[model samples]
Target: MEPLGQDEIRASFVNCTRGEAKGVTLPAPPSEIPWDRREFLGWRDPKAPARAYLVLPYGGEVIGLALRAAAPPKSRLRSNICGFCTTTHGLADITLFSARRAGKAGREGNTLGTYACGNLACSQYVRGELKPDVPQPYESLTVEERAGRLEEKLHKFVARVLESR
Candidate 1:
């Protein structure tokens, strides 16, 4: 991923009004982000933990989404896997996040959700750079391959958000 500026990030949102996009609270300016270590930029709003955002270069353009994190599930499974990076973690570490669909569908209240890292750190989790809460299952794929899959999954998810409208 390439580095982004504040204006670019704010203007990339496809799922919300320009005013809403302008009101988004970025975790930090793009200059502080480790661009090489991220597949996309994501973070939860400190003032509103349930509110989150993801921005990425997709389909040859930068796009962004406004997401809301669903409450953690009370399932029997001891661990959960992130749909984007396939990284395993304690149930609390995996969260279901929903994004309002772009355009008229969003205006109509349509939304889509996917299980993802609660901290939105799938990029680091997939690379073994972030600590795991549970013993992760071994995989034969190299780090690059895993990273590639993460990108593919992320792109597909973003596509769903865009196409839902």
Candidate 2:
């Protein structure tokens, strides 16, 4: 995926209002990101750990989404797998993140949730920069294939969010 500018990132959000897009914090510049190894850029807000964000280059334009982390369970384990990168992680490292539906459904409080890396490091995990304690199902696949699969899942999730209304 190509690097994105702050303006482009802000304009790419389909699941949030314009004011919300302007107010959210963006990840570092493209030069700071390891683009060659990343399928998408994701990060948690420093000021608000509960708030997360994901941005990817989809179709001919960039697509961004705002995510909210769900409350943790009483017990922590290391067996959960991220839906995007398919990497297994400890309970604290995995989060159930939810995205509000786009447009009217979102304004009405509808959201979709999936288990993901708590730190939003799916790109790194898929690239093998961050190793999972448990073996991933895609271990047999080439790194490029794994990354492609991750991107496809992300696109589907985004589509679901936008079409849920």
Among these predictions, the greatest lDDT belongs to 1
Error of 1 at 37 (Å): 1.5
| Predicted candidate 2 versus true structure: per-residue lDDT over 1-165, tens digit per residue | 776778888898888889999998766766787777778889998888899999888777788899999888667465788899888887777899999998899999999999998898888887778876656663588888988899899988988987964
Candidate 2 differs from the real structure by a C-alpha RMSD in angstroms, to one decimal, of 1.9
C-alpha lDDT (0 to 100) for residue 32 of candidate 2: 85
Worst 10 residues of 2 by lDDT: 130-139
Which sections of candidate 2 miss by over 4 Å?
A: 76-78, 133-138
- Show the colliding residue pairs in model 1: none
lDDT by residue for model 1 (1-165), tens: 999999999999999999999999999977889999888999999988999999998999999999999998989988888999999889989999999999889999999999999999988987889988799888999888998999999899899988955
Report every candidate's CA lDDT: 0.91, 0.84
Superposition error at 8 for model 1 (Å): 0.4
